[model samples]
Target: MIIVIDALNRHRFKGLLDEMHRLRARVFCDRLGWDVMVRNGREVDEFDALDPAHVVCLDADGDVVGCMRLLQTTGPHMLADVFHGLLDGEPPLRSSRIWEATRFCVDTKKLNGGKTRNSISYVTSEVMIAAFEYAREAGVLDAVAVIDPVMNRVMCRSANAPYDYLGTPKPMGKVTAMAALMDCSEERIQAIRDFADIRHDVFLTEDEAEALFRSNREAPAQRTAPPAPFPESKTEKADQMPKLPRAPHSNALQQYCYEQVLNAKSQSDVDAAQALIEALSDALGTTSAAELARLARVEAQATRKSVLVAAK
Candidate 1:
């Protein structure tokens, strides 16, 4: 399945974004030998800070296995800035109706077979289909993709070959990179889908997506943030709990319940915390509160157990 993550909902899927950056590092930096900046095992650039929409392909386990980045052509994009040499001294393409697609990659380690158009393990076509569909939905008419000869052939085999090429291909590192313009229309989307035999929706429900992100956040390998300090005692913790910072959807009641769950001292307190979460979810008419409550309770219980173990 594929999920469209943009500036609006990126906060809710930080873990997924982290994984995508790491995957890019593995594919572009390590495998393709692209001279890109990689930091702390992640491939992030200024474009990521520009709030581009990402078309992410998830495996059956809801893990991000493939992704492509889309940026508005009117602004600073790869062809205009990084790969300007490929333009042959011509002005870079810039238009609101046109967008730039770059950083296209897939997790080869997760693939079960060869990189073929019909192979079930290959996700290149699926990601391409999702990208075009998403761009069309976003009102973009065309997309310019920066791809190598290998990916160009892959696009041809997938039945979604580019309609036109910009400048001539130029040697970049070990491979040649060129600009390919693609039409973001139903015809192109259908061609890729038909070639891949995908007829169903390729997106996850809100609940499934939330659960997947939560699971990724709780993974041990993702423990990059500093630990929440343990208080000397339950009373001290109650007095020292930090105030919840204001956010886009700051809910006073939800914050109160969160702090209650965090400072919970007993099984009764935990039950009350869960009940408050259910009530809040019902009042807000959102399923996310319940999921948040579940995560809070799990974290609280784990912390409590750890404290008990330390005291022993």
Candidate 2:
């Protein structure tokens, strides 16, 4: 499964982000030897502080198996600031619709199978799809990536070839970097999906992902006694009961949907937004909060009554 984490929601996925950073440390610093900074076994840099959206893919065990970072071109991104050498003395291409993708990696040790669904190849396609689709939905037009030669070839072989290149390859120590541009188009997404034969949706709703993470939290391999400082008390048995997860997206999504429906200026707009909320109700299979639903009905009825009085 794939989850897009950015500044708005990164706090909710700290553990997942930690695992992703550690995976980056292993891939970029240890294996590929990219001369990245690894502090406390996590490969993070100044770019990470910029609140880029991290497209992270998780294995079946909920461990981060793949990840890539997306940063807007208007800001201080790697290509413009750190990788200007690849721009060939040209001003860094900066546009609101363009985003820079960097630090793409997958856990090869765990996803060792060849081109199968659970393999590295398939996961790579999924990550690319997530990044492009997510960015496109957010109004991104093209993505520039500072990638090694190996990734460039992999993209070509996997039907994700870049449509253009910015400059000649520049050797950055052991790794030679080249800037490649890929469009965030439906055709591009579909072609990658075709190459990987992946038909299912790659994204998980926040609630669904939270439930999965709750279930996937690892348990102790062997039963162990409580630590000496924290001795078990008589009521500890009750406290140890597995906690139930709160319903996902019911409160927040329902309120937002109802707001969209009720606050619409025209009846047609109201109907359209109401239809969306109904569809969400079916998809999530969760009812809105009782009080909020009651309040929405009351307000809706009042709006209709006012409209009738005005017409009469």
Candidate 3:
């Protein structure tokens, strides 16, 4: 069993501080060659101790495997202070639901099944579930992550997540791109499992889960990239291509989706947006897409009726 724990919030998650730090040191510093603030055989930092939205993922053996964290834009975040110049303008994070997905580390040996007994890459499902569960609880509607395109596909296939691209692949010593959104549903998750070709009967059928959620069949992912997060002052950044963010928790990801849906000018536009939201809601939670569609249609009707009444 994989466990995802939110360990950053000092007020809420103070108890797991030590354990989480050990896990990070084990994975980030010891496994991956990233320099971390480790002291006395422990990974500890002012940022790690202070950032209240850090999340950790543990494997079946109760060992830390994959981990990702959020740096909130509503406050002073790392993206703005550290890597803002790497982006186009004011970072694409302003006026948008943005948070950084930093400290993303995975036990590559675990996923690839190397000499190490404790590995994370092999059991991606548990790691993804823990990550999403924690993100939802942390109230992170969207995330800005520096992900490799190849690893992005693997992560998407692993988690069945639908994500949107933020900008061109910034080759900052590696093929990295800034991306956003990390909400995925059980159905898409199952799809990811299927893509991975895991034959374990332990996994539930995404189709069955979708039927229960009243979501539709798996639609082909929208391949096109979205508009740049900032104005294109630089030509090279403007021309580069990237994949869209996974549409996980789209409806459940209400902070971003609701505003986009509500702003649609035409009923057709509203219908399309509502349908997308329903699919996402179906996958992420127990709620059915039809239920969401019904609610949206009902709300639309009510709004229309009010408009007529106000016209009188």
Candidate 4:
């Protein structure tokens, strides 16, 4: 499903946004060799801070598979500021009715296999349809997309080809970038839908989106480390711990447990930390906190072993 994330509701979907940024970093910086700033595995720029709308496609596992950014052309956009060379001597187009679309990418690695068109093409068309529908709903008349020749070809194949071009294509890094203008009309949106064979509404409800974002936040920590081996001494009695109500200060408890795990020095210390985390997880009835604690413990254990090896 596709989710429209903007500044007004960004706080509620921070996890999803983080994932989108990471995906952008992987696609643009790592794969495409784009000259974009990536910090801590997230691709973010001044445009992101300008409250642009992000149309993101989520897979069945609630992971972000594709995304496209939309910004008002009247303000500072990529074509007007960063890619002005492509415009030659012509002035950058600026209009409230026309929005700028950029940073369009998909996780091709995750969507590698399919029978007909492959997952990349499928999600790419879906994102385009969602972007056009979102722009039309927001009263936008047209969209100016700063894309490469490859993406231009993809747009043509999807039956959502641009109606006009701003200027000549100019080489930027390994790819040539050009500005293509597209109408924000139902006909364009429907064309992409039909081409992609997607007829259903590609949006998630607010509650469902929130749940997916929360899962995205907790899942990384859980997957970072294998489950800690339960110490034999505490194995039998661990299940006897009383099930308490969810703690109001669960965040604080999680932080404390994480710190404890990080400070662990030996196997016994790590075992105790794991046992404490399990106890807290049972009490709060949430695995997120325990997962974080386990991640910290695993990191500390690895560091300790490395130090021992160095000392030997």
| Model 4 TM | 0.69
Candidates ranked, most accurate by lDDT first:
2, 4, 1, 3
TM-score for candidate 2 = 0.71
Q: How high is the CA lDDT of each candidate model?
A: 0.74, 0.76, 0.48, 0.75
Assess candidate 1 and give its TM-score to the true structure: 0.68
The top-ranked prediction according to TM-score is 2
Worst lDDT 10-window in candidate 3: 214-223
TM-score versus the correct structure, for each prediction:
0.68, 0.71, 0.47, 0.69
Clashes of each: 0, 0, 19, 0
lDDT of 4 by residue, 66-147 (tens): 9999999998998999999888789998999999999889898989755233388788888888898888988999999888
Q: Mind giving the per-residue lDDT tens digits that candidate 2 earns over 141-191?
A: 999999888899999999999999997899989989899999999999999
Off by over 4 Å in 3: 2-19, 92-99, 109-119, 137-140, 159-162, 173-177, 180-190, 193-312
Please write out the lDDT profile of model 3 over residues 60-173, one tens digit for every residue: 222345556665666655556655644666454652245566666665654565322243444555445545544545455655666666667766646554466654556544
Please list the residue runs of candidate 4 whose C-alpha ends up more than 4 Å from where it truly belongs after superposition. Answer: 113-118, 216-312
What is the alpha-carbon lDDT for the whole of candidate 2? 0.76
Better of 1 and 3 by TM-score: 1
Residues forming the 10-long window of minimal summed lDDT in candidate 4: 236-245
